[model samples]
Target: MKGLLFDLLFYAILIFACIYVLPNYVIQRTIVDGSSMADTLMDGENLYVEKLSYRFDRLDRYDIIVFYPYGRDNTEYYVKRIIGMPGETIQIIGSDIYINGEVLEEHYGKEPIADPGRAAKPITLGDDEYFVMGDNRNISKDSRDKYVGNVSRENIGGKVIFRVTPLNRFGPID
Candidate 1:
């Protein structure tokens, strides 16, 4: 009976770690809530966000990330692609995005940006700041909006690495 009891307790602990610790610190399941990343990540799709990579490496431009807008205190999380890295100046002239006065070459934007928003003028990022935007540029409220300025490294949750739901769409996300 004592041996059985010990086994039960050990299994309970293992189950707890799998259910709580892993999801919180390792990889978590997240759902895409909007069309901001359409044609890349669609709404209602389930994704696996890995929290380990950013701990060891710096976030690179074009990496899709999930973050708490403003701060972690806010419940809502925004997923966006990093456009401008730390210490870079970002500005949008017409439909082109300029990073440090050079036009950024990326084909992620579903359509030409219709509004420059705050990015109409050059915005320099701090050492820990990153400028992000949605793939659906015209409708996405991202760094261009006053509400979701530059995302701080601390507010970043993790990188979206895989798609799980809608079985046909299951694969690694670019």
Candidate 2:
């Protein structure tokens, strides 16, 4: 009877670790809720976000990340691609993105940005701040918006690593 009880306790602990500890500390599942990341991550698609990478390596530009917008609690999370990194100046002029006075060459945007939002003038990032934006430039509420300004390092939850839903589009997210 004691051996059976010990086995039961061990299994219970393992189940709890799988259900709670893993999701909270190592990796988590998140669903894209809007078209902000379209042409890359579609709305309603399931994704696996790994929390381990950023803890060890520095976040790189264009790494799609999930973060809590300033002034928001954990209840809300926004997914955006990192544009301006720490200690960088970012400006959007006439549909062109300029980083530190040079044109940023990238093909992630679905179309030309129709609105520069608060990026009409050069915005400098602090040591731990990052400027982010959505692929659907015109309609996304990203760092350009007053409410969703620069995302700090602490607010970043994790980097999106893979897409799990819609079997046809299942693969690693670039």
Candidate 3:
């Protein structure tokens, strides 16, 4: 009986490490805060964001990313899709997204953007910056805003790997 108890305790610690400790370095669980990423990631939806790959890799366009916009000290995070990569120019004209004068094709937006916002004019990203936007273009507070501008590569925390909540919509985030 004592041996069984020891095994249980061992397993409990291992499980705890996997659920809590390991995530600090490898992955984390975050929830969608608003309707910004709507249609793709609904408000209140849970997501498993992975940090391992991005640690030694280059981010690709269209990848969904999470970042600490208010500095790493604050806990506030924003999740958005990468629309323009480093060193590229981004602009929005009449509800269309353009990358260096080429129309960017995407299917995630909930509706046509009513406010072009700061993206009305071409904005160029530096070598270490990225332009991000939410799927719900009309209402998302993303890279278009002055404060939110192009997210620096260092501010990006991880990429969304999958959704964990609302069992009916479980699996990969894409």
For candidate 2, the lDDT comes to 0.93
* Whole-structure CA lDDT of model 1: 0.95
Candidate 2 at 43: error in angstroms?
Answer: 1.0
Number of the top lDDT candidate: 1
- Residue lDDT tens for model 3, 27-113: 999999998988899999999999888979998998999998766778888999999998999999998999999999988778998
Write down the worst ten-residue block by lDDT for model 3. Answer: 68-77
Tens digit of per-residue lDDT, candidate 1, span 1-174 = 999999999999999999999999999999999999898999999999999879789999999999998699887999899999999999999999999999999999999999999999999999999999999998898999999999999999999999999999999999
Give the least accurate 10-residue stretch of model 2, judged by summed lDDT. Answer: 70-79
What is the TM-score (0 to 1) of candidate 3? Answer: 0.88
lDDT of 2 by residue, 1-174 (tens): 999999999999999999998898889999998999898889999999988779788999999999999534657998899999999999999999999999999999999999998999999999999999999998799989988899999889899999999899999999
Ranking by lDDT: 1, 2, 3
Error of 1 at 110 (Å): 0.4
Total backbone clashes of model 2?
0
RMSD of each: 1.3, 1.4, 2.9
- Mark the regions of model 3 whose C-alpha exceeds 4 Å error after superposition: 1-21
What value does the lDDT take at residue 89 in candidate 3? 90
